[model samples]
Target: MTSMPVESPPKRATLRQRVFRALSGEYFWLYLLLLPSILILIAVILIPMLFAFQMSLGNTSIVVVAGRGSINNQWVGLQNYLSLLQNPSFWQALRETLYFWVVSILIEITVGIGMAALMNQSFFGRRIFRVIVFIPWAIPTVVNAMLWGMIFDGNNFGALNDLLLQWHLIQSPIVWLNPSALFPQIPWLSNALSYLGSNLAMNSIIVGDEWKTLPIVAILVLAGMQTIPHEFYEAARVEGASAWRQFRQITLPLIAPVLTVVLILRTMQLMRAFTLIFTLEQFGLPVLSIQAYQQAFAFGSFGMGSAVSFLIGLIALIIAYFYIKRLYREEL
Candidate 1:
């Protein structure tokens, strides 16, 4: 043993020293790389958000006179929020927003998953089918909105209604944009038939939105499905499992993380669905975002408007926080 002296083991750094080294060592480059994005994020998101929260505490009478500046205001306290609580339109908008997300996303998730699963199978013209599905997702949101507005135009300008009429699907061009058609029969919850009709009318804009965005969901799900190993399916088949059975067991479990990611992304996307809804509201489809904009700009209830915007921001912030937490938890 004396003829072969062994080297001593390296000592472990203390936690505080390790942390100090992390702050000052090669890993400092990670922070350096993150700095620009952090600054940009602060400038674009965090600072603006702080300003909005401060302004939410103030009203136009106090803040507008001084310009949209600073983190101080006349401090309307909780008046804006209290007003929103009592405001019927705000409440209605919020209710509609919730309904839109719940129903539309239900359809989107179900349809998107089924479509992606189908597209993932070894079928003929798979590439063409994928391209077809992806085309709508590729369209600009503004353009998609505009196109839907045109399609749902209450006047004789709608291609969809024209086609329906041409195909003898209906006797006349259905005025889809009519407020009556869009929000008919307020006592819908009283009866199943009325409720179904109300749901159809209420979901007109959602239909257009689904058409525009379902392709994206499909693409995302397909990407997830593609990441699953072929061996897993092969093994399942070797054990005498059918395709559906194998998907139920192996494919679905493996793709759950991706499904969660896609869902979270779509949730955040639709929560602040402003531009499209705004354009659609031009056709009288009133979603929360559009209603908020209308209150702030069109109706000039400056306090109400700010409050509505704050509410929208609050919801989005909560969803994003939860989603990020879920992502981190899943990672762990």
Candidate 2:
């Protein structure tokens, strides 16, 4: 056979060229569609988050100086984290935050489930009742906190105290915000339990937060409840199943998905609860968000504050992970 010139395969594309081609290909429109959102997310979220992380690794002076429009980038590796670990205040804040979050969520879920159930049923003036229930959810959180704070004011003339006094519930007005007054002299309880005093300030804030947010959960659950078929309940009723049994077997399982979603969203929100507590109890209850704010603004310790913030985020992530896992398990 006659000799023929040999040919080499075309050169492989570089990573950049491949990426460019991919972006320029059939998905070009998709990439173009997403470009603005990506840029906005980078500008609004990722950049600030990374910058905050960088600041968390530095000294307080870095943030203080930077706030003044100057740069004094002094790197101090892990010292702030270490100090937070050693800080009693951080632990106390974490403990209180966990307690408050758990208790608040429990109460909110109970109230929300009840309200949602009632709203799901036929009743007189139900539309007006729903509007009233939803009004709190529409109110600004700060305003709700302020309203509750006034209601629970330490003064004898506070709304709740005045009501109680009028009802002959107490001889004198009880200072609901004062720990000492809330607990009095409970010898049986431990110091922490007694000192915390049903966490009056914290619980007051929790109640306010719950009041403002409960309607949201209820509405979501109601939406889910509406999706459930009437046939299932009718069949259960035909089988002579009691109301509680029907709720336990049918309503709960049918609504589990919605409850899970509501739980996760509420968990995340409650974990970072700040505005309500800040306006109502201030730092009287040492929750992590409150501590973070106190550290950043009150004490001007930005590094520590950033550490506290990252820690809170970490806790929220962990909690979300478990809840998400539960969701997955249920779906499976």
TM-score per candidate, chains pooled: 0.80, 0.87
Local error of candidate 2 at 155, Å? Answer: 2.0
Off by over 4 Å in 2: 1-27, 62-68, 181-184, 188-198
Give one digit per residue, the lDDT tens place, for model 2 in 1-332. 99898898999999999999989999999999999999999999999888778778888653345347653546898988899999877777887788777887898678888889999999999999999989988898777877887898877889999999999998887666653423436655646663343555666667677878989989999998999999999999999999999999998888988998898888788778898777766777668888888887898778778888999899988988898798788778
lDDT of each: 0.74, 0.82
Look at candidate 2 and give me any clashing residue pairs. Answer: none
Tens-place lDDT digits, model 1, residues 1-118 = 4678779898988999998998789989998899899999999999977776665666743334445643224678888788878877666667667777777779877899999988
Model 1 lDDT, full chain set: 0.74
